[model samples]
Target: MPCPACQAPSPCPQPHVGTAWKPSPDVTVERLSPGLPRRLPLRQILCLLPLALVVVVAVQHRSVLADGFGHLATAEWPWLLAAAAATCLTWVAAAVTRQGALVERLPRRRLLATQFAAGAANHLLPTGLGASAVNLRFMAVCGVPLARSSAALALYMLAESVARVGLLVALLIAFPDALRIGVLLPDGAAGPLLLAAGAVVCVALTVLLLVRRVRTVVFSFLRTALSEARSVHARPARALALWGGAITFPALQAAGLAAVGQALGLPVPPLHMAVAYLAATVAVALVPTPGGIGSVEAALIVALVAAGGPAAVATAVVLAYRIITVWLPLLPGALTLGALVRWKVI
Candidate 1:
């Protein structure tokens, strides 16, 4: 007799008798199982999508970009170079902060690349969502548990916020008149703004205290974050990297704006320009705009004017600074982000 399915000489008519039938090595199991799912090409699509979007955005904003470059062309080269340097250093500062948040050591190159990719993603999503999402993925990929990663992210954010406010207060103490809130706001707006901010904080605190489930989650998160922070601070290098990077990050950003101001011949003093940059960024930090795009530009322009620069000049400086700090690196960052996706780095 011969086996029916895979015909071969056999003692019995049954397919399983004598010798078991087997598909040739060249045939895959998928060939036998018709219902097997094919692998999706999602990673490749994700890798390319951002790059395509970047090109489209660049093309659509060609005129504005060209004008910004034109301004840079005639501006002071040395100051522009310094601004570029500061822009580059911001990535490094970000990477250091990320490393400080984790106890495990990430590969240096990949970690830095993740930060670069995170920067691109940050602009694509509202506030810091893009960056936070990327970092979370990266940490998970690096073997950090989800809860720990989330805690580390919270700690990083807290540290950065504290450092920014501390720097702002220090600057205000040093230059009391650098920015007048009264001048920036309408006659009756300042008091209302303060009250609104206070009300929001109180509401949030009340909700956290009143909701049992929410309070439990919040307490769990805080405990995890505190534990992680304590562990990180136990090591001197990590402590320095966390706090030092946090402080330096905003300072470098402020320096970049001041450098741009100098490059464009803005009449604001350097310290005043720094103050304006910090204040504008801090004020717009809560805005849900992607990378604070529109809000940041408007705020920066206003802050610069309030800091004693002419409105036209302030506008020009803001445009130029955004070009150098945001627009120029955008394409490269997108490309890098896509590469990281394809490589499964995030």
Candidate 2:
């Protein structure tokens, strides 16, 4: 039936009907913008000021760096070979750590690739945050929840720290006289002991804070810190696995450094290199600059020098370590990033 002032087909309306055509409130609507790829702005490029500073430092040290290359040319192949082997082991350790974190295991190949990409990003990114960000992105793409990813990163990081501390403590304890007489530790060996004590305190505090009751109350004051550490306690088995991996990872890295020392004909002992490795790593990790570029180079060189190597020898060893660990992985990581893009993983 058609009835209305405008002659529309509808129910009859006599005289004046209060009928009005209206859409339902439940409809979903959104604005649509035309597709146009966005370009990075110049200002955004300028945001990489920290990275630029690292480049400047590297350039400024170029003269000393040239000599390091000469040292590498005359170096033995055995140590280089050992460094390569240790590098492989270090990646394997990372994969093991990741596997331990989750209920289900991710493919070892994928995890290895992810770690490589993450490490590469960390080397380039400011504040070493890139690696964590990459890990999170990769996990999200794989359907892992944010909570799980957070926990995994924390667990592995904590485990690695503990392993490093343990190794250094062992070295200090085993060669008490060496530490006692060394210029760096010369305070009658008290300095190294004190440092070891401090590391123990940090470990003790970590355990105490993990208690449920204390976690509830103290967590408020430690909100940010706790939030960061939340992933460490997500799963007990996972934590154990991560710790095992962490211990192996740093030990392998120390081995690599030791190999570099040997290749360059430096008389630095592998065991002593382990202690220097821990100290240099902690210093670099604490630096505000991304991946500890300038700071890492400086810390490593300084530590190696202090550990009885000459300036030239220290420079060569540090550069070699950077090459094997940092630059060697970058090209593959770039390719990995491209593959990730093609697969729509990020």
Highest TM-score, which number? 1
Cα-lDDT of candidate 1: 0.89
How well is each residue in 102-189 modelled by candidate 2, as lDDT tens digits? 5556766778887776665676677658777877777777887776566656655667778788877787788543222354445568
Give the alpha carbon lDDT tens digit for every residue of 20-68 in model 1.
5677667787888879887669998999988887776678668768878
Clashes of each: 0, 2
Question: What TM-score against the true fold does each predicted structure earn?
Answer: 0.89, 0.68
Candidate number of the best lDDT: 1
Off by over 4 Å in 1: 1-25, 28-40, 59-63
Query: How does candidate 2 score on lDDT?
Result: 0.69
Q: For each candidate in the order shown, give its overall lDDT on alpha carbons.
A: 0.89, 0.69
Candidate 1, position 257, lDDT: 93
